[model samples]
Target: MSIKNITVLGSGIMGHGIAQVSAMAGYKVVLRDIEQKFLDKAMEKVKWSLQKFAEKNKISKEEVDIFYNNITPLVDLQTAIGSADLIIEAVPEDFDLKKKVYQELNSLAEKNIIFASNTSTLPITELSKLTDRPDKFIGVHFFNPPQLMKLVEVIPGIGTDSKVTEEVTNYINKINKRPVICKKDVSGFIVNRVFIPMVHEALYSMERDNVSMEVIDSAVKYKLEFPMGIFELADYTGLDVVYKASYEMNLRDKAVLLLHPRIKQLYDSHDLGQKTGKGFYEYKGDNYERIDLTPEKASKYDPYSIIGVATNNASWLIDNEVCTIEDLNIALKLGMGLKMDIFDFFKKNGPDNIMNKLLELESKYGSFYHPNQYLYSIK
Candidate 1:
């Protein structure tokens, strides 16, 4: 089905950006929120973002006006989604709240309208069960800043129609974004599955090896060539978000994913990273100035220890047929903003060396670090 009219529910950070992008792609977008004030705020943000794009020469001033004008904000759900051909839900990450929204939409929306969730952690398959049109329901996991982030993870639930998946992927491309198809609707999908585990390992390294966060952050930034250190990224992403994502993934796969104690403590204390000015580190000023990580400190910890865990998790995704190696590599590079392919370590170090590293990590970190069968097969 060709989607011409899009309805973006929630009109918050992700929702507003999704609406703006869809409008930029020449789709009529209805941005909906429960309150008029939220709709007003969302429109202001959308205008500001579009103006920035214009100032940066990314888009013409007239194009910004056109894009900004293309979005219609509304508070009433029935009026907002009445003419929508596709609905993308970007509500807060509450399971019950999302289910409630779907229940309401199921009754109000036409059966033919495709429903997509911007959920970062919850399984698409489980969410599809909440609606009558499971075949039309899919997950379009957009990164935090939808306006800037290029990668979009297209996840089709087990019962989702292949045709629907293709249509959504094509729609994503039309908006000038990269779409990596995730074959299975597992918790955390591709990027987070690989990322969260790597962060957990970093925390474990700090706790077990007694290494400082600065050393770990320095090693990750300089050694791994990541734009930001693991802790830095976590803080930037908000510790509450990280903690909740870890909690959700753990609930689904407790054996392999565990929430680290430090994450929980920071979250409980409400020191949620850059937004709150404190998390793994402290942030000061309105712009949230970056924490300086010294390059010399990179030598203190071996980054391969963390890379080994990421490699094992990526291998697990491949072995389980969750996503192709090509897609996984693209997802990491685009979604997680990795400077290199996730399996570059496995390829450079060879499977045997990686296995030995995993074995060593497993002995120190428990069964979670144990290598998947794919690594052995390659060996």
Candidate 2:
């Protein structure tokens, strides 16, 4: 099915970005929120972002106005979704709230209107069950700031129609973004499943080895060639988001995906990273300033310990058929902004070296670090 008119159901951070990118892609976008003030604020941010694109010469000033004008901000849900061919739900991550929204959408939207969610960690299968048309529902997991992020994970529920998945994949491509298919509707999908454990290991190392956040961040940034250190990225992503994702993943796999105490502490205190001016590191204000991680500090921590955990999770995903090695590599490189795939590092460091690190981590951190069958086979 062809999707022309798109209705975005929220006006929050992810919602607005989704709308912005949709508009930029020349789709007629209705950006809807419950409150008029919220809609107004979202539109202003969209305008500001469009202006930035013009300033960067990515788009002409005329094109900025044209794209910005493509989006129509509205408070009426029925009116916003009335002419939509696709309804992308960017609402808050609360399951109950999303269920209610889908119920309302079900009652109001046309029968053929495809439904999509921009959920980061929630299972697409469970969410699809809430809608009348499970075959029409899918997960389009966009990273933070959808307009800027190139990676969009296309996840299909068990009940989701394959044709629907293909159409959405094509739509994502039309928006000038990289689309990676997550074959199974697993918790954390592909990117978070493999990456979150790496973040957890970083936190664990800090607590266990007395490694400073700066040292860990430095090692990840300099040694691993990631754009940001794991701690810095956590702070930038907001500790609450990171904690909630970890919490959700843990709920599904309690033994393996346990939450880190440091993350929980930050979340409990509401020091939610850059948004709150503090998390693992302090930010000056609402503006995000990258933490200065000195390369000299990289020597204090072995970045391979973190990579070992990530490689294990990647192996688990591959073994379970959640995604292919090629897709996982693309997802991590694009979604996490890594210089190279985790598997590349795994191969470079060699299976024996990575296995030894995993064994060491397993001894220190319980069975979660235990290498999987794939790792053993390689060894």
Candidate 3:
């Protein structure tokens, strides 16, 4: 079936951008929020986004005007979905608010309407049970600043109909976004599941005295060429938000962000990163010079960077039938933008040579250095 009428909930950044994109893609879009002020803010966000596209010559200014004309800002949810073929909810992470929105949609939207959530961590399958038509429920998880990021994790729950899944996937791709299908539901889905833990591990690496923040950040940027060092990214992305999301995922353990088990205890004592001006490294004065950095001050934790490396060893999971080698490499390159020099050469050196390097790494780092059991067991 063709999707022509679209409705998006929540007038936050994600909701507004989703509405703008659908409108640009030639669908009538209704953007709804609980209040007029929120809707007004969301409309301004959408207009500015379209203007940026015009400035870059990606689309004409006239096109932005047309896109604005196609968007209808409504404060009423029921009226917003008057002719919706798909309704994507991009509300806050509060579970109660999401549940209430779904309940409202359940009584109002037509039987064929598809409901999707832009939740970063909540389970789509569990949330589907709140609707009368579970068959129409799906997850269209967009990365932040959706207009720029190209990928969308399309998660279909146990109750989701296969036809609906295919239709929505096609619709997302039509608007020029890559849709990576995830089987069933898992905490943080796939992207966040893998990415967040890596960030935590890097923090621990510095906390345990195995590496200094400057050194770790330097090694990643200069030697490994990661887009951003782990600790630096935490500051840039807001350590407080990451800390909250981690605690939410890990059962209120504050140590995960601190990279030490006592992090929460310390954070509660006003040791939270950047946001508090203290965190892992103390920001002294107005220029943000790091003041408190020493093995004694920050390195009292454990060294677990090897675990992070081991997790990235493609052979470990692939050879064991956990995931295909192709998907593993794609996840690293496409998702994380990582390209290990050893892995790059290993492709040309073949399996034996790759196995040998893993051996060397294991000898230097620890057991995490070894490839998955399948690699060692190979004849």
Candidate 4:
């Protein structure tokens, strides 16, 4: 069955965006929060975003009214979810809080209604277990700013039915988003599985090599042609968000991937990137001026070392059957907006060179930098 009505739980950053996208796609969407103030703020943001779209001709001026009308804001949970064909929970990333929400949703929601969480790094299997309908529960992780980001990671828990997976994938497509299936539910899924470690390695490089944040950011942005440097994106995404995601993933792997202490220091100080007006680099409003860091200083730290560690982690994911090579690439390209073929770089650099660099990093950082079996098999 097609999803006609979608209920977006929570009216925070992700929730509001998800609701807007669903409404824009012509689905009747209920944007629910616990408080009227939060609902009002979400609505205001949606209106401003819709107006921006209209000015850009992304949506017609007349269409703005149609889209806005499609979204209904409510504080009452039962009233909001009563007719929902699908409910996407965009709540805060707290285990107890999510479990409690699902427990209550189990009683309030219809038996057949599909439940999806927009969790970044949490296990779908664990979240599914909290509800009565494990087979119907799945993860529909939309990248930040769901209205613009094209990719959605559709993940199925161990108990999730294949049909439920197919339905959720179809619904994501209907909303004009590309769906990359995470065949197995693992912490960090696919995009963050590869992306987060890369950023963490960047931080480690800065710490070990004694390079400035600007040096690392400039090299990654200029040399690698990424849209934003590591620190720049971290600030844009909020250091606290990244730290929390890393901390959650660390819980499963005995802390193999640890956030740099500098990141934790920034997070603790509430200097959370663009949101808080400061992070790794200072920002003037939404604009961050590049400080003209020297590429010579950046060259002191090998870019390939960081790239190899991320690639090895990607290979590890492949080795474990978390996702196929094709799925992982698509998730990174579409979800993280890498916009380049990750595997092609391996072909260009050659496995021996990549492996050698990884080995060098491994000597300094231990097994976390060690190449996975897939890297070994790559000849």
Candidate 5:
């Protein structure tokens, strides 16, 4: 639990944020990237963040100086990570790139040093195969904007040592973040596996003429009562990101790929929701208002009731021991920003009713509506 030095590989958004938080926590943080320009840009971002904190009165100017002083940008892996007690790999999600990082880390780290990946999708068990100490390796999935977010999904692969897991969890808590331990490594871990599918279905709903952005969004606002509608979130998270992930999910699992021609067309055209300034609606400005005259129809009769049913099914994941009641709640709140505990949501509306509704959606939406097998047995 005592980390004197930490190394953050990659100078991308996640890496810089990781370094920022680590430096703030008083650890000597070294952020590594290939080129000097990348490190320069990352250093600028880190300074900008600390300055923003100072401007907002979150931290004093002197404190910002202290934090920035603790952070160093490094070009050489050996110099950056040689003495690191902990390493957080935040490189690209590409497998080969990550494995290369792993090889370099394996050569540098001592037998006791822990290695963790900041990946959202790649399997931890697979990553463990590359490292000599799978027992010392774990998945530490931090949500974006690490300083603001509170939750970290701490996933341990099949061979990951329990002691290593506990130590890493303690370190995560030390950084003032909540750690949700995933007992087994599953694709997308726990939150994204369930949540991403929901996003995928929403895209399918949009394409199937099942609903309009305005209607789906309104029904979601009025019904399930998410902080923001799914479409709005899609815009924020970038439609292209979810689309590609879903397509991979479909490719991996023969179940419910949503191969509907209309959906495919959207993917092919690269109409990513908010980031590219297009998706269900052409997004514009900070609030992401729609610029198009697309039909704002409800895809189904009483879609809110139906979405409630789906979330109800999601609750059963707890009953089946897929994750604890607290883990599920934290996932929604931290990973997706739901307002309240999901256990409360499930207790309010039981699971069997949800199962029946999932069936209803299944019949209407084809593969998009297949009931999650995890939900059926939660009774």
Candidate 6:
């Protein structure tokens, strides 16, 4: 089915951006929230963002006005989604809350309307079970600030219909976003599955070796050419978010993964990175210079070893049939904000070299670094 009317539930950070992008893409969008005040604030943010886009010449002023006209903000969920062709939920990452929303939507929504969640880590299959239309339920996970991020992970639940996947993929493309299909409903999905563990390992390395955060961050930034170091990205993403993701993943593999003590300490203290103004580094209104971090102390840590764990997990995704190697590379490059394709890096460094690095890391960090069969097959 062709989607023209899109309803975005929850007018929070992810919700407002999704609504704005949908409207900008020429779709009629309904942004629903529990309170009028929240909706009003969200609308204001959207307006400011659109104006900035217009000023930057990314969009015309006339187009911004037209986009604003396409969006309808409301407090009534049923009314907002009454005629919606597709509804994307961007609520908090609580499974119980999400299940409740899906149950309510199941009772009130039209039979043919597609149901999707923007959940970062929850299992799609479990969420799909809460809905009446399991075949139409899927995960359309978008990166933060959907207006800027280009990658969206389209995941299919165990019972999702093939046609529904195609329809959702088409609609995402219509919004000028790239879609990386995750064939399985695994924990952390594609990008997070590979990315988060690497961040965790980096934290583990720093704490274990008593290394400076700046050294590790600078090494990953300059040597690997990543947009930011893992810790820096963690701060930007919120340390709590990174911790929760790691905690959740560990539950899935009880014997293997563990949240490093430093991350737990930071999360417990509520110094959750950019949002809280303190994390691995301090942020003073977009300037980190106040922290007095010296990035010149190059790390003793091996860059390939850290990246190998990530590519090792990427290989596992291929082994488990989550996504294609090409799609995994695309998702990693875009979703993780890397400047280069990981596979290309692997080619330049050689598969044997990567395998040796994984072996070395596994010897030190345990089975989480153990190379998947796909890596073995590479040579």
lDDT of 6 by residue, 1-379 (tens): 8788999999999999999999999999999999999999999999999999999999999998999888999998899999899999999888888888888898899999999999888888888989998899999999988999999999999999999999999998999999999998887889888777777778777766677777777777766677788888888888887887777777775533545677789989999998888998878775554333234654444466666777777777888888998898889888988788776565555677768877876787687667778777765
Is 2 or 6 the stronger prediction by lDDT?
2
- Where does model 2 exceed 4 Å of error? 377-379
lDDT of 2 at 5: 93
Identify the leading candidate in terms of TM-score: 1
Off by over 4 Å in 1: 348-354, 377-379
**What's model 3's overall lDDT?**
0.67
Ten contiguous residues with the weakest lDDT in model 2: 252-261
Clashes of each: 0, 0, 1, 0, 4, 0
lDDT of each: 0.88, 0.87, 0.67, 0.83, 0.73, 0.83
| The best candidate in terms of lDDT | 1
TM-score of 1: 0.96
Per-residue alpha-carbon lDDT of candidate 5 for residues 1-379, written as tens digits (9 for 90 to 100): 5668899999888899989988988889999999999999999999999999999999999998899989889999889878898889999777798888888778877888888999887778889999999888899998878878888999998888888888888888888888998776755566666666666556555555555667766555544556677667766676655665566556555452344343456667888777677776676676756332222332332443345434543544554566786787788788887777654443344555655656776687554455555544444
TM-score of 6: 0.93
Compose the digit string of candidate 1's lDDT tens values, residues 187-253. 7899999888777778887877799999999988887778899999888888888888899999998
**Pairs of colliding residues, candidate 2:** none
Q: Compute each candidate's TM-score over C-alphas.
A: 0.96, 0.96, 0.77, 0.94, 0.87, 0.93
Which 10 consecutive residues of model 5 have the lowest summed lDDT? 292-301
User: Could you tell me the lDDT of residue 247 within candidate 5?
Assistant: 61
Which ranges of candidate 3 are over 4 A from the true structure? Answer: 251-335, 339-379
Assess the local accuracy of residue 228 in candidate 2 as a C-alpha lDDT between 0 and 100: 93
Task: Report the lDDT tens digits of candidate 4 across residue range 300-320.
Answer: 554676667667777878888
Estimate, for each residue in 1-379, the C-alpha lDDT of model 3 and write its tens digit. Answer: 6688889998887888888888888789999998999999889889999999999999998999998989999998779999888899999877788999899888898887888888776778778998988888998988766887777778888889999889998998888877777664655555555456556656556654556776665544444444555566555445554554566556532222223354455446766666577665656555645332343423343223423343444343444343345554554455555665324423432456546655765686566445566545442
